[model samples]
Target: MQKYLILLAGCPCTGKTYLVNQLQQQFKDSFVITPDEAKILYAESIGFNCKAEKEALEHKVWQFYYGVLQLYMDAGKRVIISEYPFSDKQKRQLSEFAEQYHYQVITIRLVADFDVIWQRRYQRDRSPERHLCHIMQHYHYGDTLENRNLADDLITKDQFYQVCQMRQYDQFVLGNLIQVDVTDFTKVDYSRLLNELKQIVKL
Candidate 1:
């Protein structure tokens, strides 16, 4: 049987970790890999700030986690990887890996309002060694109104909306992807979301 790989891609403070924790609780047999855990493990090895250094460390971290994911998959286990799949390059790499392993990849993008995230970041207590402002400024993973224009020529408004929607929907009809807006989970019908996920995978 092929292993199931659910990749949770989202911005910080968007409840990715919360959802991951819930999933782990519900599915005790599944393996969960989170970037925050990786950062905590290798913080001393990789200095803070220094975009280049951070990028290198992130690459190493992802590679390590991906290897671990492959191990679980090889054992026919379900795995959940929670990370910010920001760039197109990273997504392509994941797609390639899935193709190579013949594993089913389900990507979930969690999103929230910028102001909400900003406030969340501000309220979050960080170690004295790390500055919250610096971290927030440096983390560039989401599609915002400012950068949306960068790719205006390549995609239509509707297509772009679909791309934004991909954050939630995962896969599109054209096999491109869908975006799910979880702005207010309290107002959203979570049962419908669960049903949608069930339809996609046997989980």
Candidate 2:
């Protein structure tokens, strides 16, 4: 089996998670690394509360995430990193690693209009499925984390819009780029997407 490093990059609420699930189903043996899940598990192992010690959590998550990525690559497994907005520095690092390991790199970037992205984020904020750590970090405002509810996500909404407007969440273009328009999830052609990906990765 040829090894691959599949990088899913996009802004928040851009349907990366949904694509991750689709890819997982399509490629059963491929290893998927989700940073959010990694953060949660690492926090638990270290007795770190995201609500209380939020400052260093992201740094820790990236460190652990990169280590795990290298390990899987060394083992010659297909690795998928879901929904990361990689910085330029990170992209260069990944490029070097991919070249060293002879792994084919595929980058899938999901994009949508700001309005659509906001609507998706709004619904996600109200949904019970969203993890508490995410809510506390993104949605927390003047309210205490313990007493906060999902009735409002004002602060994060404004911040996210501004960030997206400036394209902060967009990552640098990398190997075999496939840009997907996901303004409307119902209209996204998953079959065509899978076929396109299969052609490039030769899956």
Q: Find the candidate with the highest lDDT and give its number.
A: 2
C-alpha lDDT of residue 167 in model 2: 57
lDDT tens per residue, model 1, 79-181: 5444553445456766666666666777666666655654554444333333222343233233133332232223333554455456532332112232556
Runs with alpha carbons beyond 4 Å of true place in candidate 2: 47-52, 79-81, 137-154, 165-167
* Model 2 steric clash pairs: none
Candidate 1 local lDDT, residue 136 = 31
Where is model 1 poorest over a 10-residue stretch in terms of lDDT? 169-178
What does candidate 2's lDDT look like per residue over 86-198, in tens digits? 54657777888798788888889888888888888877765667654565543222233443463333346788778765755664567888888889889999999988988
Winning model by TM-score: 2
Q: What is candidate 1's CA lDDT for residue 157?
A: 38
Deviation in angstroms for 106 in model 2?
0.9
Candidate 1 Cα errors over 4 Å, as ranges: 44-56, 125-178
Please report how far candidate 2 places residue 59 from its true position, in Å.
Answer: 1.4
